[model samples]
Structure formats: structure tokens, C-alpha cells
Target: MFNISLRHSALPIALFVFTLMALTKMRPPNLWAHTQFLLSYDVGTVRRSLIGQGLAWVFESGLMQSTIFALAAVLTLSGAAAMVLFMARALARLDGGAEVLLVFVTSVGMVTFLCNTGYLEGALALVGVAALILPVRGALPLIAKCVLCIVGVLIHDIMLPTFALLVGLQLFLSRDELPVASRIALGALPVALTAAVLTALFLLSPDAAESYDTVFATVTDRALDFPTRKGAVEAVMSYGPGMEPAYDSVWGSDLYRFELIYISWIGVAITLWLLVAAARLISHRPMLDRLALVAAGLGPLSLLLVAFDVSRLLGVAILHAFLVIAVVLLIDESARVKLRSVFTQQAIVLLLIVNVVVGFRPLNGYPEFGDDFPGAVMELPLWWNMPPSGGRLTQNPGE
Candidate 1:
């Protein structure tokens, strides 16, 4: 179970406050679109689908903007806390107290992505991270993990298939710990429950038929929104060829693409690095560990199939897979394979590189370029700048 002792409470509290202030200062203009559309229940908005509006609706409608941001900070800390505790427990189980530094390094990587610019993603990604590390030996934890995995899909459908497979793999591998009956039921439970939830939310609504009609129209409209060049073969083409410039006027295209592409490459590199490490570490491990390595290792392939924002997808997948790798490393550490030796001077170099790349966002003259250095330090290098707050149109459509 996750206990909040006095000693550990301070860290989460501090993280919450720090993240709250940072996210507050880091708030971009475009954020309003996501919140406003979700809060208004505007099912016709095609850009951000309603798949993952469960948590967004809660935060946006249940609280004032200022209060809701604080809630976001709390959720961010909660995800960070999960990472720290999970890593710590994994290390302790391995009797690798000497390699606490490795735990710290891993925790920092998780935080870098989990606490990234988007407040909503912080919660969604945290739920994803928790699924990766939650204790599954017991029935309760396993069920909870399934529920979270389902909820994660509902929160953002872009990575649904990838993460759903991940949840399934975990359930299938827990056969040794769980009875055959339990394993079979758990495997089927998540998808069943998810279907139930979706039915209740969208299908059972007052305008059930109209809801589906609106959803179809919205999806079709969004698909047509991005037309290819005259002779292009695919619907989605790379930026700069045929697509018109759609960057917000405030960003002015000065540093967006270069920085974005830079981070995308970084995301790919980190994803490969973590998976390669897991492959090596889990070579002789139990079936569960080996299967998890495969699932986490291949989860990033979603990038190729889905054209959602590359920066967020890659970054989130990298961190999510990194957490799985860290878990495998700790679980499979042999008497011969020591943490100290696993991460030597090379680990220091890796940590430094991650901090530099993940720490800095592209220069967008945010908070007035040189004006808010403190915000820059806490929330600099936002993956993308949103339109200003309060500038969003917020008329409720589905009310």
C-alpha cells in the first residue's frame, strides 16, 4: 500500500507547491481550448476528442481556474510520488541501497516527463506510470491497476491500444501469482469494464443516437481538416511540404520547429536506450519480467501508427518505458549483476544529458523572455505554447 509517513509527506507537499506555482506561471494560451471544450462538453470539437475528458471535466468544472491548477500540481506530485516510492521499493527488494543514485536518476527522468508543461498530461501520464509500477501480487492492486489502465485510455485515446496491450500483458503474466481462474477473469475484466464505462457515458446519454452522429461528424471533420497536397498519397504528411503554417501568432515560428524536432529526436533516443537496457537485464528473468520488457519495449511503436503530437507521445512513452526498465533491472538483479556496476561513471553522463535536454524548452519569450527567470527555471522548455488564458471561446454546446 502507499503510505504517507511524515518524513515522506514533506516531499510530496513541496513538489505540489513547486509544481503548482510553476504550472501557473507556465500556463500557455492554448490550454484554454482543451479545458474550455471539455468543460462545455462540446462533442463537436474535432481536435481533442472526448475519449479522455473524465479527469479534465472534473478539474475544469469543479474548481475555479486558480484552484484547478493547484489540483493539477497535486496530481503531478502524486505521480512523482508514485515513481519515487515504486523505485525505492524496487531497490529495497533488490538489496541495492548502494545504488540509490540510480533510483534518483530514474526518478528524475520520470519527473521530467511527468511534470512537463501540460498540466492535464501530468495527471494522465501519472495514471499511466502508476499502472506500470503498481503492486499486482494481490487481487485488489491488480484490479485497481486494471481500472487505472482503463481510465487512462478514456482520458486520452491516442495511446489506447498500446496501453491496453500493456495492461493485458501484465495480467497474463501474473498467472504464477494468481489462480488460473483469477488470471482469466482479470484479463477479460478490464476491457469489459471499459466498455461498460464508455456505454454509460456516451451511449446511455439522453441523446444517444445524436451523440454517435456528432462524434462521427467531428472525426470526419478533423480528418478533412488536414488535407494532403494535390498529388500526395497519404492523408498525413510531414510539416513544411504542403501544410500551411498553423503556429500561434504569439510564437511567431522563431524557435518552435527546431526545438520540437530536437526533443523528438531526444525522445526516440531515450526510448531505444531504455528498451535496449531492459532487453539485456531481463534476459534470464522470470516470464513476467521478460514479458513486461517486451510490452514496454514495443509500446512506443504507437508513434508510427498514430499522428498525435510526437513530442508528448514520444516523451511519455520514453519515460513510461524507462520506468518499466528500472523495475526490471531491480527485480532481475543477480548476485553477479550489481547496481553499482550497472551504473558507473556513464550513468552520471547520461543523467547530465537528460537534465540539459529535458530541462530547457524552446525559447518562446514566455513570461516575457528574460522577465520571469524563476518561472523559466521551474517551467521552462514547455513542449508547446498554448494560446493565452481567458482568450478561449467557452460557450457550452452540450448543455
Candidate 2:
């Protein structure tokens, strides 16, 4: 039984259990404005591309149009399956206790934030991450990697930054295997590729840019719109003074506080983990390890560009955290052992129990309004905290 469990049931059993919990936590597609945007796609606007149009078509189907929960569950399960298969394959390629820890950490990370988030873009982000983490062996694999990068970007342009970060990490990790000049050239590839694709896409469909521009304007305008009567915006936007007002807003003060506490905790944890990983990499001082150290150090800088939005910042942070952990494990075997010791089997059991308990809440997003699954769940305890959603579909205070 022990051998059988270790060889077969360990990862699959855990993943299956988490998938069921995540399904219950899945929020209906219409709750958020971005999902709504995808749901309302039309030929007249450039707001959506292939993915959006596909989702809109699916949702428009007779029963699907009204059965919002079914749509959410399908997306969550499909994306979760894709991510689990990719990560399992990646972990299986390696051997030893390191494999055990990587499986645990990556699985927890995905269930907590990356996978089964019930958002189309979040699902695509996992696909992008899996494509990046997959081992490259030959020219064919490299070509596939590039294609996956393109697909991820086409799904959602925000992934462009993530693609660039992965490019930098890849170049660093493979530096010793290639020449100096080749490394320099590879460093520029992500930017050049992104530019070339954007230019081509614009030439093919200029209206996409127009649609995104309109969306950006709408997003910014809504953020700036505040309930001046109670100073809700000023309070939430402030990092220190007078935060209580927004925290007490009918829009859901508890949610705002939860987001602040959760994000801050994530930020601190990743920062500390990076430092510890860097120390290990510095000690051995292998070329590849050193390169990974530098990449980890520079990775957080990308968040500066998207700092205005909290969700985007957290999303980037989560991706960076995953990248840092993966690279450190590749270079330093000891780090994996350290992770296994700290995380512990009992701790994992507790986490799984917590996830199961939360699954009963029906407290998915928009709890300020009411629970869509009132008897089943109660709060948005998931890691992916979205920024205030608004657009043509939902009302922002000013709109």
C-alpha cells in the first residue's frame, strides 16, 4: 500500500481532491467585468479575439446562456486539468525527493492562485506557465515553446510581460550551454518577437488596438471615480492614513481588508523565499545558478510597470514566485529538501481540510452583493483577488 500510494496516488489523489473543492469555489462568469466582456463579444468590436469569441459562442448556446454555474465549472475544470497534466509531466521527468517537494509546492500554488480560478484569462495564464516550465530538448521543442508563447499572448495581451520574464529566465538558465554572443541575442528575442506580433496583429486588425484603448480608458475612469460623500476611494487608495472608511464601505470593507492582508503576506513570503533561494545559489556559485539568481533579483522590477493595479501586481508576483522556486530547485537540490521539511505532510493535510471547509461557503466573488450559491459557500478566500470590476456590463459607482 505504501509503495502503491507513493508511485500512483500521491499527486493524483491530492489534485483530484483540490479540483472538487475549487469547483465549489468557482464564481459565475458574469460576476466580473472581464468575463462579462468575453461573454458579450461581437464582430463589431475588437475587444475580443479567438478565445473571447469562442467563450461567447459557448455561453450563447441555449441552456448555457442562463446556466452561469455550468459555464464557470467547465472553464475551471478544463483549465485545472490542463495545468495538472503539464505540471505532473514536468515533475515526473525529474527524480528523487526533489520531485516530491516540487510536486507539493507547485500543486499548492496552482490550487491557491493559478489554476481553477474560473476566469478565462487566469486559465490561459496557467497554460502559458506550463508551456514555459516544460523542458526544452531540441529544435522542435523550441519551436513549440515559441508557438505557445504566441498563443498565450493572443489570448490576453497582459501575458506579454510574463512571456518576456520567462524569456529572460530561459536565457539565464541556459547561458552555460550556449555562447556569450548567442545569449545576448536570445535576450532580445522576447521584445523583438512581441513587437513583431503586435505590429502584424495591428495590420491585420487595427480595431483590436482601438478596442483595448477604449477598455483602458474605461478602467482608469472607474478607478478614479469615488464615493466622495464617504471618501471610499481616498481611503482604499491610501496605504496608511484613513483606510478604515473604504474598509467600511457597503461595497464590502471586509473584502478590501482581506485583499490587503493577503497580498501583503504573499509579497513578504515571496521576497523571503527569493532571498533564501539566492543565498543557496550564491554558495555553489555555478554559472547557471548565478544567472538564475540575477533573474530572480530583476524579476520583481517588472511589477513596477503595472503597479497601479493590485490584481496585476499580485498576479505578476505569483508568477515570479513560481519561477524563482522552479529555478532554485533546478540548481540547488538542498532547497527542495528544505521546502519539504518546512511545508510538512501534516501542514498539507491541514491546508486540504481548510480548502474543503471553504468549499462549503458559496462565498465566491461579489459577496458584497450576495452569494450565488448561498447554502454551499460564503467568502472569496481564493488567492486571486481581482481589482474592482466594471465596464458596459456592470455598474461602477460613477457609471
Candidate 3:
């Protein structure tokens, strides 16, 4: 009886373990994250200062590491809850059982949230989740959606591509329910609002009145410990020169180096796997619908041209794809039927085993790209056996 009960309760056990792992591995708010909340209108209006400005109004100079940590936890938990709810609803439609849920909990997109806790990624994901839920599940006013998009952009301009992909796909999928003019306006409104906000932030916001040293001093004074990554604070304060130093490191000619290329291909493979899974869930749809969905899923990758955070962006793309898929599963019976046919117990069990082996890792800038790739677990044994004089593992293996 005990063994039988344990077998039946495996799913809940797995979920509990996964949550514990995420909590245990949670990192402290880094200097970049601290710098984001430290910035405010008092320093002069700047890009990505909205959150800081709002916190400043409420905290009235009481912002500290504890506050930032608490806020980060809230945002991360809120986003995770939203995502799990959506996933649960979608799985319900497919009659997906323990194995399928296990696959989801272990999947790269979900695990990215677990491993890379406490960053704007959580807040950005929350906005994306709102985009998914509000359109289908709620009667949220158009103005509210517009306001959400505006807030998303203000949080970080990276929200633009993510917003575009999600909102555009949702609008596109609603073609049968809404009129042509309404759809066009609905689509264009967010774009226009985003553009206005971006212009105001970049062109109209006042330049920093203080030097990097002055701003850094002010930020460190509020912290319990010395903030690491001074360059991040410098970037926020100086705006231009401080940003230049990262260019060569992140986007240098070595972009095409063999290791980076290999890691990038691994990311691409994982992305393709996700796209394939989404496609399978909607295989019964028309060719146009299928193509459009795939296109939207691929859209976030365009951020590559401007951003060097390959793994993080790919994780965003994967989550964006999942959110879009969940929306479709909730609203479209045809898609749900396709998902049911594709996600059999045997298939889900096999996928779950594979995902568990892949496990989870932090997906950030280049080299550390993609959670699906072999990470610390795979490399640790080799490191343990290496000669003492070999030194630590550097980003570039040749070094």
C-alpha cells in the first residue's frame, strides 16, 4: 500500500523537489539588479527608471538589499504562479497526467525561471503572462492592456520583442472573432504606445546630473555590503562609455568562435524542440495558422541582433512560445484535440526522463547559453580529476 501510494503521488513529490531545488539555488540580487532599483528620477529621468522611481515614492529612501530581495521574490513567485496556472489549464485540456506535468516542471523554460531567479526577467515574464491571460480569460479593458505594455517597456526595452510576439499572435489568432479594422487597431496601438515610450525614455529623459562616482557612492551607501559589478552601476550612471566596455566581451569578433558557435547551436536545437512540441499541439490547424504560430515563436530571436544574452533570450523565446501555446489550448478546441493525440502517456514519460537528465542551469550571456546544454553537473567530474596547476575553468577553454 505504501509503495502504491508513493507511485500515485510521484507527481506531487517531483514538483515539491523541483520547488525546493529552485529555492535552495536562488541567488542574491546582483549589482546589476541592485543598480536597476537604485536608479530614480532624482538621478535624472533615464531609461529603465520607472520601477526605481515608483519604489522611491513608496520607500522614501528606505530602499535597501532586503527590500530589493523581497520585491524580487514577489515578482518571481507571481510570475511562476501565473505560468503554472496557464500550464495546468492547458494540460487539463489535453488530459495530460503526471508524466506530462513532470516534463513541464523540468523543461528548460520553466527551469530557467527556477534557476535564474531575481532579475527583470521575472517582471518581464509577468507582463507576458498578463498578455496571455487578459486577452482570453478576462475582460480587461483595452486601455489596461495598453498600460501594461507601456509599463513592460518602461521596465526594460527588451519587453518590446516579447510583447510584439505575444500580442501579435493573440491578435492574429482572434481573426475569426473580431473585425478587420478592430484587429488592425488593436495590433497597432501597443506598437505605437511602445514607440512613444521608447522615444520619451531615450530622447526626452534628462541626462544624468551626477558622475559615475557620485551615483555609485550614493547607491553603495544604501547597501549592507559593497556592490559587485561596478560596471553595471557605471553603465546606468554614465549611460554611454560605461556600456562600451561590454561590447567586445559580449559581441566581439569571437562571436563566431567554435565553442560559442557550438553552444549557440545547442540553444537553437532546444528552441527547435520547443517549437516542434508547440507545432505538434496544433498540428490539426490549417497551414497558415501553423506557419503563423511558428513565426511568432521564432520572433523573439530577432533580439539577437541587439542583445548578446543568447541563453536568456532563448529562454524568453521558449516561455513566450509556451504562453502563446497555452492561450491557444485554452481557447481552441481543435488545438486541444491535437495536443491530446500527441501527448500520450508513453511519449510524455519518455520526454520527462530526457528532460530530467538535461536538468536545469542558469541561462545568461554567451558560453553559458541554454539550460538544455551540458552544464555544471556534466563538467564537475572532469574538473575534480584535473591537475591542480590547470587552474579554474575559464570562459574560453584555450585560455
Give all candidates' CA lDDT scores.
0.45, 0.44, 0.60
RMSD of each: 10.8, 10.2, 5.3
State which candidate, 1 or 2, has the greater TM-score: 2
TM-score for each candidate, following the candidate numbering: 0.57, 0.58, 0.78
Candidate 1 residue pairs in clash (backbone atoms < 3 Å) = 29-386, 29-387, 29-388, 30-386, 30-387, 52-154, 52-155, 361-381
Instruction: Tell me the lDDT of candidate 2.
Output: 0.44
lDDT of model 3, residue 220:
60
Considering summed lDDT, which 10 consecutive residues are worst modelled in model 2? 227-236
- Kindly list the per-residue Cα lDDT of model 2 for residues 343-396, writing each as its tens digit: 345544554343233211111343322222211222233234543322111222
Highest lDDT among the candidates is held by which one? 3
lDDT of 3 by residue, 130-167 (tens): 76566532346456677788888888777777765566
**Model 1: runs farther than 4 Å from truth?**
1-37, 40-63, 93-118, 129-141, 158-166, 172-261, 286-292, 329-338, 357-399
Instruction: Sort the predicted structures by TM-score, highest score first.
Output: 3, 2, 1
Which candidate comes out best when scored by TM-score? 3
